[model samples]
Target: MDVAVAGGQTATTSHQLDPLQRGLLTVFRSLPRTAESVPGRPTPLVLDVGDVVVLVSGTDRGSPATRDAVLDLATDAGVVVLDDLPGRTPTGRVSLVLATHHTAATAAQHVAVRCRAPVLLPDGRCVTPGPLRLWVRPEPTLTLTRPDGRQDVVLHDLHLRDVADPDDEHPAVVDVFAHPSGSGLLLGMTDGGAGATVALSTGPRCVRVPAPTTATLDGVTRTIAPGTYRIDLAHPPLYRLHAESAARPETG
Candidate 1:
């Protein structure tokens, strides 16, 4: 089926647009944009148009910061997000909605979308946005005092200031590696240090794809040997998927 999809085309009179075209233009142009635009370039927009004819409107010609998408799409076929879309993200590193599930369309992924983590969109193409999960690092902590420039995925940020003896505090150093069982964050494990890192949070933690030796994360893919990269979820609470299922639309 042919479905009209308009992102940003403005400065047009009413006479030039049909009822549907005009409606789309109004939804596309009237909504706020967060990304900066160049005269000869593009801007990415994310809008959460009120629950009307649409749900989410992402990667349009407006702004990059808008958290909600306000566009409507009706298609029986599939939609693909090309690699070029990522380049238009907002300044400073930020998460961009590459794809999403729509009632009228079907989306499938060969990599990142399948595992529900943010990985490189192979060949610059996005799969089913429905399955793409946002995996945030536990805020990598680094100190320059050490010669190695030791970095850590801070599972816990609050270092007991006055509660514990100053000398007995855990340094919060972490060493990540692979676990044959699954893709989950392994906490309470010691890094050969006096103290161990732990998780007291609710969200599921991420495990190195395959193992730490084959490092690839943060939307950045590394060229490594096969059988070395596999994404896993760790310590995922039961309520996470419960809430996730409620938010996602059901498809036949």
Candidate 2:
């Protein structure tokens, strides 16, 4: 973790200041990391995971690199942000705390900050809780390998993978996610889409050529698309797609 103060200097580093002056700095200083001062020009911003990227300008229009870096780190690594930069809550990427210097110009330029959780903002004289917004986007993906092993592709993974089937005989195996509904999802192929029989804890499901085939489970017939699909599972322990032979069915 790292900490960056955006106002050139803050009470946090001042020896003459009180405990409140330190704000989150008291905790940030305890962590082992490097601190950097952001300049008011667009410089290339490079970052590592779990970095504390701070911006301190209430005006200056600081480095665009720093601004984009902070948001990118937050999106990828959930980095902590302590910004008093003079700008609207930089849209997109969650986990943000915005504060600005209380001034007539700032008041006119900035809008009311709205957050799902409580946040502290700097108001020139003191730090206080204010309305702010929190944005969270949890989109994920999973890869499924076709039987031919000709083409490889990625599919959206919207559900949890809890199903497991271990085969001691066939050590080389793979798993894929899917739903019973007809979603028209396609499993990525490496070379071909040959038909093969895949084993599932539920039972053996046949993979036919030019699939999007129909399978009846518990007397209900449903279409199974060619690509990997994310099942709308309701329970914790569910099944995954596994093969019975040395030939694995999926790659990712």
Cα lDDT tens digits for candidate 1, 1-252: 011222333323234222332333333333232334555533323232221121222333231222122222311111222232221322233222222222101111111222222221111111112222221222121111111322212211211111111233453334443221222333334455575555432233322222223232322333432121112232221111000111356799
Model 2 residue 91 CA deviation (Å) reads 2.2
The best candidate by lDDT is 2
What stretches of model 1 exceed 4 Å from their correct place?
Answer: 1-84, 91-174, 177-197, 201-252
Model 2 lDDT tens row, 131-245: 1111122112122233443221122231112111232333222233343222233222222235323222232222332335443322334454453332222211111111111
TM-score of 2: 0.21
- Candidate 1, position 142, lDDT: 13
lDDT of 1 at 45: 30
- Best-matching candidate per TM-score: 2
lDDT of each: 0.25, 0.29
Q: Give the Å error, residue 224, model 1.
A: 12
For model 2, the stretches where C-alpha displacement exceeds 4 angstroms are 1-12, 16-19, 27-87, 98-117, 121-252
Report the error of model 1 at residue 235, Å: 21
